[model samples]
Target: MKPAGSLALLALLLAGCSAGSGLTTGALLGDDKPAAPVNDAPARAFQVGTASARAVKCGFNFDPAKLKTNYLAYEKQQPSGQDTAKIERIYDVSFNGVAKAVAGEGEYCSETKTKTIKADLGRHLAGDYTPRVVPKEQEEGLFSGMGSGGSAPEYKAKHPMDNSD
Candidate 1:
């Protein structure tokens, strides 16, 4: 059997290493949890500035006139107030992601469909730009599909079955 004295010394050494304090004094004291690592995405005061503009255009098929009018309505109706550009960017990002996921489906979106996509997209962006609840109900028809009915858009016409000749 090994000496009991060696086992006690080994335990002390292990405890000191695990405690993570290089100083001898610290080994007698408890250790603190490591700091949470920083995320790479910068937290901007006006967050989503980069993504907002593109999102609005891509998600909503509104022209300057229409987009302005819809924004005005959002300002009037939404209690949280509007940061028109910021909200737009968030929607634009959401739309692009969803469109890409659906394989460029935004190209054929309708007014209602665009709004629906905006709502779904808004939810995702809300977490991204916290303390700012971007309105989900900006009524500009941004994309090109009707909310309910339409065939998936095709890039070119397919050959008819009759071509089997």
Candidate 2:
């Protein structure tokens, strides 16, 4: 459970890495879907930052201050001589309710997993870091044997003589 490996990691990413305001607000407001390494850097950065913040806020003992500063990304309009309005993401940072330190409850991760997540998140927060592309094989390993090729192992074990194809 390295948070950086295996099936669970894929799930975390597929969940839209839902944590930051920049995750969807700008695109939703501007009617433009920003692609990675192109225009979504801010949104991507915010998502990772928010996750670190959440881990710290949730008491996973993640980092420096154990706090998360929420940020909002908004699309602003400016007067221009061009036909189309200029679109950009404006950021707003917040630091309220940080002293409360709400302790996380239930299913705490081991220190190893916590550290792994912290490191992974940190790498993602960097400016020039592109995400590590997980190979298709690794991603499919967990579910590769599910409902395919034959019946469940238990079913075959129960019907010992029923080997007819």
Candidate 3:
């Protein structure tokens, strides 16, 4: 009984040590969330850019002309007392990130990728982005044919009777 209890205590201590052994203070505390971006002007701008980049990576389409228009709209909607330079800096960083992400996707011609990404980022910044949602009918249809001849191509093609030879 004593040996069993000692082994259990040792196991618990080892587990605790392993769990607390992360190099960062946050990791030691078991907190995995990223620290909030700094409040300084440049840092805030970078955060805004990072957020915009992430949005593009998540599938928002690019449209530059619309983005410019949206930026103008956003600028006009800002309170009259806010600092213009700070706002511009944030916008600049955001647009740069957006461009980088869009161009990285390789979905468009090289010449037009930058333009498309810029537009897409602009659309996102203007609050125009929305994730594509499958309609209920379509979702139902997808599962309706499951396990039947009309299911996925791979499964249907692999069915024994599907071979012409």
Candidate 4:
């Protein structure tokens, strides 16, 4: 092949390689938005837990295990020579709110409840909110066995008549 034809083929291959890597030529050229990380595990877990707690406070039965969380890195930047990444974790609470509505057993969460969930999530992500443990009385089955006293154990040596009986 001629030199021009060879150079064109090489360019095409490079373009194909870059595109396959999820970074388009436009992104590489600074014309398109860069891709962000999605559904980060830690962030999602925190969000779901926060939402469930807030829902419980609002008198709704929401299960954290049933909550669905989605995370998106709204902004990410690496300083010119720095090795660390500056990433902003953005939570999609709306989807989880909808999921709560579908999976929840009680009344639908009010708008204020959703806002409180989001606000609490923001505070949690910002390291400002500390989670409060539910009181033992509020937890399920805390008093189910209240009247059952401990039974005394019978020792075989002390009760020698067992075999004859």
Most accurate candidate by TM-score: 3
Task: Kindly list the per-residue Cα lDDT of model 1 for residues 1-165, writing each as its tens digit.
Answer: 133543343334334323234344432453332222222122221123222333454554434334434433444455555464544533333333333334444453555545544553363344433222232232123232344354643212211100000
Each model's lDDT = 0.35, 0.32, 0.42, 0.36
Candidate 2 lDDT over residue span 76-150, tens digit each:
121322212111111111111111212333433456446545654566434222332332222333244467766
RMSD of 4: 24.2
Q: What is the overall TM-score of model 2 with all chains considered together?
A: 0.29
| Top lDDT model | 3
In every candidate, how many clashes are there?
13, 0, 5, 0
TM-score of 3: 0.29
**Per-residue accuracy of model 4 over 87-146 as CA lDDT, tens digit each:** 111122322333433354354456744665655555444533233232223222323334
Task: Provide TM-scores for the models.
Answer: 0.22, 0.29, 0.29, 0.23
**Candidate 4 lDDT (Cα, whole model)?**
0.36
Ranking of all candidate structures by their lDDT, best first:
3, 4, 1, 2
Model 2 misplacement above 4 A: 1-39, 57-105, 124-129, 132-165
lDDT of 3 by residue, 1-165 (tens): 254553454344324323233357774685535433233333333334443554455455654445545554555564544465655545554545345534555543333434444454564565644312222222233234465665453321111101011
Worst 10 residues of 1 by lDDT: 156-165
Which is the better candidate, 2 or 4, if ranked by lDDT? 4
TM-score of 4: 0.23
